[model samples]
Target: MPTALDRPTERPADARGRVAELRAVRAQAVAGPSARATEAQHAKGKLTARERIELLVDPGSFHEVEQLRRHRATGFGLEAKRPYTDGVITGWGMVEGRTVFVYAHDFRIFGALRKAYGGAYIVMESQSIGADLTYAWPTNETAVMGAEGAANVTFRRQIANAEDPEAARAHMVKEYKSELMHPYYAAERGLVDDVIDPAGTREVLIKSLAMLRTKHADLPPRKHGNQPQ
Candidate 1:
């Protein structure tokens, strides 16, 4: 009797062949125009997903896993469309010799739509292998900034209609209260481990990596799905 890692005695070769065929179909589907288009878009941005990962990790130390997985969609009308890594790039690598798993949104393709298979695989793998740290930088800050600016404009207009200029002053106070208060709140809640100057990002990451190396041994294993249980 063969083990699961080998060939199971119960399963037929036809079934295994079908599995291999489906994997091949998935790879072929996503390896076409969509993948090329996505790469071109990233090139235009002067930032490939892989380059971003390289910058974030230690030079010559990062090792990537699962670089070839692609989207598997069989939905109506979408069956013909290949989603190109489901619009997200995921893999594990070393940051200053510390192991970590990362997933970055590919804003150039499908706006980071979740592919059922690839998405689930990354999520499950990350959970099982675990990572010392996770980092997420929003790729769509332009939209967020626009919405915030619009809200500020609306508040200013409303303030101008007030009977007292003091009321208008209060609007300014409220605006800062909402916007500027968050960073301090994040620090207090420990949501942001640290906030460092942009120029010091490399130094900060190095220090963080050092700290994690020593600290990781003391910390318990990370739970799957990031749940405590």
Candidate 2:
């Protein structure tokens, strides 16, 4: 099963020259888009995807798979932009002694308890999407939607009726975050397990993985059904 760090299952056919091809691709995968991209992430106080993975797993334990896969999307502006790895890192690594398959990408975070805004985008990779264990950083935005949209839509009538519409909107936006979207609201209510520091994420994950290693389950077989593409 795919975990947070891996989703693609396609692997290239084995052939004589595959080792050389993979070595070249692996070198590219480790570098990311460019040195400038690394600078940009550092500018925003964020780690690159691979760096985060390395931090979470045992040293020298991650064995990345499917690094040569590409997307098949044909239309829109996507046709000509088929980059390798599909902009995600998918593979497995040891967490303590457990072998965990993982993937990394820009995930939809779980909601920040009460969101008061526009149509909420269900994050495709959040706990709401059935993640077994979820974690958040102290600085994560952790909202279902932006505070501005929440205030504008939820308090539309109040803003329009107020003598100072802009002031009303501003107050409502602040109220929305403070009253409904408090940073620790999710952890308080069990929506998320905890709020953690970025530097401590690896240690926390190691502990959590150890705790979960004893849990097991079996899914009942289900009838196949046709689903829309």
Candidate 3:
């Protein structure tokens, strides 16, 4: 999907051209760089984000959204290498005849049964955040940000003052991930409810959704809550 993002920003001249553009981007987003890469995922016993979504929603029911969005982080030689969907495939579809939205960020999330968390991790609905139930795979990591970013923010002085800054940074990043970012770490502390196998995701979701199907939340009756700050 133009990881370098070289596509023309200009809109197509006609509806047909626009439709063609849409199809082209969808193909690129779904198929990725090539078929071989998809096969590599299978070889490693993993499913791509798209495939994982397909595993949950009813057949032919899933519809993707924002398949053309790209990361805006620049200046790591990455500005020219940012791919569309930004490694995330977000959308909605019918799950057991119920409308469900999904925000799949590569190997990280599947809403109620997924992984990881950032500042706005509520977008993926953690149990302590908004979800009724949460499940995670065994290989997930959790932190407000990647370990590198978190370490830099949390251990700024230690890293800067170390005898060997690079080694200190690396060791700290590793420690942060293992200690504070393990998947079960969140579950143990009640941030996450449980950890489930990926293969059983559909069943767990089906049961959980059924239980929460009639659950409803109502805002407290109040006036003038949006007072001047």
Candidate 4:
């Protein structure tokens, strides 16, 4: 038999102690993001990553993988912000009693994932030639109005000018959303090529592409590249 020194130095008092340790570990896993981050997510009318996983899977069935892993990517200043779980929560869980794997990342906290279908690259390239566009609703009105500090200043002035500040702000938001978000207005202003019905999108795009195939315009040479010594 191995001597005490040859055996493990750290040991739980009993089976119950080991079970308690496991509970603590599980608690940390379930905690997900910081309290402030969780609050911000809820404020945006979105569920937390953990919550999403819970909903996606049957209750009490989520078995998280790499819950305690941390990103080792370091340069400039990224080492200071090494993300836990590498900013992604991946696991296997039961959905309707069927086992399914899940990979969820909070785009708000990290970055977005882009998925494209057939001809999407060409469509996006054509669209990129025009003015940039953004969409917002009352649910995320703050993003629409631009920086909160700047928006507050403008809103304050508008409130001062109006007889009822509260009512005026609400009216302003509605009017702004209506006026700024219409595709027809964007087309008229040459911000977009045109808007077409979803059902006829493929047909319309084929015709547009056929005409654009022969269309050409003088363009400047590319400049960005690795600099020569």
Candidate 5:
């Protein structure tokens, strides 16, 4: 009375057939619907669903699960057309030798949430932000200058005295864009520990992690009001 798992070992033919079926399903999942659609996706400066996962994860570490699952939607003739994996690739993999779960939607195969209108597309686009900074959105002009508090306030007063309000605003916008968007400002202000070129990113990260392995920090005492410069 062998179990189902044991049966595969006993019956070689059945095991071979099972492996062949698995390979076929994997091929379908990798290729999506057609070669033409996959090529079009590549042309748009975007990697395919599988390629993205592979690049993010460590080499030969990705173990995809639910590769044969299909959507059960029936209302809009979805039952008649059931694409493999339901247009979503999900699995667990390693990034920098650390375990991570990944999920990617196949835009080519199943366009489930189609962007029909322009506004609808914008709304959809806003949902996928990496961080939420809505709390600072309603802050005053001082917020735009980051932590340069007194210096920025003095600069603002000088600009206000020298130029008209509209002209000051234009200058402020230019200054804000220049300082806030670039990496140099943050690096100079000691907000960032270090900044490295894209080519040395991996090497720097590994070294930083090694250095911080035994690092400890002591939080500074909370001070009331501003300190004198």
Candidate 6:
């Protein structure tokens, strides 16, 4: 009598066939809105979260992961209206054939406002998986807000008085100041490794991935809720 460890394991007839079956089941059970579906949802205003990711990554090379996980909440009476993925998409795919994790916020559902569990899930995923590069394009509405001062005052005022000459001048000045301040703030906090021009994004991502891949194999296992301060 052979022990279980001593028994020869039989290979499945078709690995691809099994993968397809699993993928189909995942699609039916867990998959949320597609990049296209999310885009259509936000067509009234702008691109969806998925659309932004597509723009950021190299074409035809994204291999998404955990795409099927749906929101588990039911008691708030909001579950019916909420998307399966809680308006957030998570996955890992190749940026120029190098592995990188992504979590794109879909504003279509709840305006990309992170509900209780959804925000935490993505934060944890990002921390644990350790993306080589993360592209967080929070909606323009949020990003445009000034952190402090008279410049912030000017920005808020300009929105309401777009036709006013004084407002327009103030707005331009405020915008320039904000742009200058943001990079400095980010550097101080170490939120970004470095900022790059929009046109250079793909090349930068490719280079970053190449650099990350050179590190020793077997990265440390993911630790939950380890977000950067």
Give each model's whole-structure lDDT: 0.50, 0.66, 0.75, 0.54, 0.56, 0.53
Off by over 4 Å in 2: 1-26, 43-45, 66-83, 106-132, 164-167, 223-229
Pitting candidate 2 against candidate 6, the one with the higher lDDT is: 2
lDDT of 5 by residue, 1-229 (tens): 1112223453337878889766765786667878888888888876677886776667899998888777767797766667777787889886576565666678887653222122332222222221111111111111223333423464677666764865765666667655553445434544333445534533554554465558676746858553322
Tell me how many clashing residue pairs each candidate has: 0, 8, 0, 0, 0, 2
Candidate 1 per-residue lDDT over residues 73-140, each given as its tens digit: 66765545444455556777767667766665555555443221323523533332454442222221
Q: Which candidate comes out best when scored by TM-score?
A: 3
Highest lDDT model number = 3
Model 2 lDDT tens row, 1-229: 1122243555556874566656766676566656776677778777766777888788999998877676777787566555566677789998886788777651111112223222231343445545577776665455656888878888899999999999999999998778657548767866676878889977887888887778887855755562222
- lDDT string for model 4 (87-195, tens) is 6788987655556667666644454332212243223332444323322112222122333333356567886688887787776666655665455654565535565
Per-residue lDDT value at 172 in model 3? 97
lDDT of 3 by residue, 116-155 (tens): 6585555566654457787777777766888898899999
Give the higher-TM-score candidate: 2 or 5: 2
Error of 5 at 51 (Å): 0.7
Question: How well does candidate 6 score on lDDT at residue 146?
Answer: 36
**Native-to-model Cα distance after best TM-score fit, residue 48 in candidate 4, in Å:** 0.7
For model 1, the run of ten residues with the poorest summed lDDT: 135-144
